[model samples]
Target: MPQIMQMGEHAVIGLDGLEALLAGLKRRDYRLIGPTLRDQAIVYDDIGGTADLPQGFGDEQDGGRYRLVRRGDARLFGYAVGPQSWKHYLHPPMLSLWRAERHGQSFDIIESEEILPRFAFLGVRACELNAIALQDRVFLGDEYVDLHYRRRRDGAFIVAVNCSHAGGTCFCVSMKTGPKVAAGFDLALTEVLVGDAHSFVVEIGSAEGAELLAELPARKASAEDLAAAAAIVAGTAANMGRDMETEGLQDLLARNLDHKLWDDVAQRCLTCANCTMVCPTCFCTSVEDASDLAAETAERKRRWDSCFTMDFSHLPGGSVRNSAKSRYRQWMTHKLSTWFDQFGTSGCVGCGRCITWCPVGIDITEEVRAIRDDAPK
Candidate 1:
């Protein structure tokens, strides 16, 4: 029941046309990775077509609470983020650096080489895009770039989705990273469902996207279709679930190093490193060497680590951050304040993953509000 009105650069496609898009990407030798329902949660994984998407499914998210619910409509991109992010795909949790094998007296070092896949990411949100950009600075900005991360990032294609429904913990609007995608996408889509008519307004952001669209059955978008898409984005922007006061936040944390707010947060924090693990911007890691009993072979491996661990701050004498209060203080200060000195931007993207996935439901926004309220007047 799709109508083809005209022909142009921008177009509108019915929900059924999604398969054509997926097929087009596959024909180009790109592996399509998208959102799907797995283990009672929406996760990013390899998908085949529209049938693999989490259709008619939505999620309810709040501080330390998350539940999957029926949306009553077959909306493809209706849910917010789950526990997983694109980070799991780009930067692996455990990476083998190299292996050594004994050949007579000397040992031969064998480097770890992996075959990087060409991936096309579907349903990428605006805040997630910002997170990926921030990670780019961490892995590829300097001379000592991570070759593995660079290969995956450079070959991946992004298809961003403009949010129409905001989650209970969502605050991307306050961080100016969401509701409407500004950049970092090959193609952007806004889902528009009105009166039993489900369609999408697609905007091409790259030559590759344009070529792909040309291969699909689509029509030039009309004025009414454009208006409907704009209104959906506007309404989503107006209904933000939480807000963070970023004005002078950097200086506030830097000056309040000895503030009592740290103690209050430490009492509730488990120091379990859930925040750092779920965080899309945290890049801390640890390396280790493993060898056999005969010492005939050895392997070097790198894995994700967190500041909450005692050994994370190990020095010549002892660990620097001994108490939970000191560890919590260091984490918050680095994320909101000192991160600017190191990366020129805040470490948080307002994605609310940390707030939703925390075991005790410790809200970062609430913590910041408490500190701001108790500051010297």
Candidate 2:
């Protein structure tokens, strides 16, 4: 028998009750998006119920390598993040800004009629929540907010998951972002499995979450359940496979503008821009205008861009960061140092997507360590 102990707003639900939660969200007109196995990797996609989740599967991730493996149990969220981040849904790779049709003597502008969809993101990791918060500062905090991003973000519901396992490339412990969720979620869940029983300890973070929990088959969580959840998160934190020393990291990069370490990494870097694509906080984009052959119709589009591209630095004189060394340095410095000046926080969330997805296994933490080690003593 499960003991019902009321401690604040925490509750426990059987693993089977997860379907009820999903159903409630869908009934409320939310497009549920969660992790699913696709192309041999766990990627986010539309999920209708527990069947759509990556059951009995986990992921093994290291620098430049990611593979899915069987965990022998039906653990819905037993893996780490893959190449796709929530940014793909919120800030799409491509968007049509506007279109225009030629008139007799002028062109009439046609306004974009795109409607942002309401999404409920499930199985979001703690570090990913911080990444979303950081992106909120970028797209919603500026003087002129991104209308599209704001619309989508405003109606989105976040269901965060406290990590029970850490990837080999994960370094959220050093970034002070994860292993446990502190905030920025509607409902947070910690998967608990012992012996042959499986359940989840759910914590309500908002009124909407409380209402949703009421609709699910959950009971008040006991003290033992809460303690078990804490221990699981603690174990994950202690076993982080990577670490990043952030002491004076901002100044360290700023002073090493001419560091030779940049050249060393550039030789191995393919300038593929995979890091930026997989990064949850990278917000660079480029705009293009396309016209029909008859020049009667034209449309303006914006697509995700990266600083690693030579064309990204094209100016009146020429490309400023022409060499790969300069381009890599610019990207790293801006991500670690200049981002603080611009956003008041580190652009990176220590999710390690950049390291895992990079074709050359270029680790950001390793680069930072190399720079710090080679600095003038």
The superposed Cα distance between candidate 1 and the true structure at residue 344, in angstroms, equals 1.1
Q: Each candidate: how many clashes? A: 0, 0
Q: Which candidate should be chosen as best, given lDDT against the real structure?
A: 2
- lDDT by residue (273-331, candidate 2, tens digit) is 99999999999999999999999999999999999999999999999989889988888
- Model 1 scores a C-alpha lDDT of 0.88
* TM-score, per-candidate, Cα-based: 0.96, 0.97
In model 2, the worst 10-residue window by lDDT is: 1-10
List model 1 lDDT by residue over 1-377, tens digit each: 24322222457888767789888888878889999999999999999999999988999999989999999887889888888888988887899889999988999999999877798999999999999999999999988899888988986888889998898888888788988888888888999987699888998878778777777778888898889999999998888778899899999998899999898888998999998988888889999999999999999999999999999999999999999999989998899999999989998889898899888998989888888999985
CA deviation > 4 Å runs, candidate 1: 1-9
Clashes of 2: 0
What lDDT is obtained when candidate 2 is compared to the true structure? 0.90
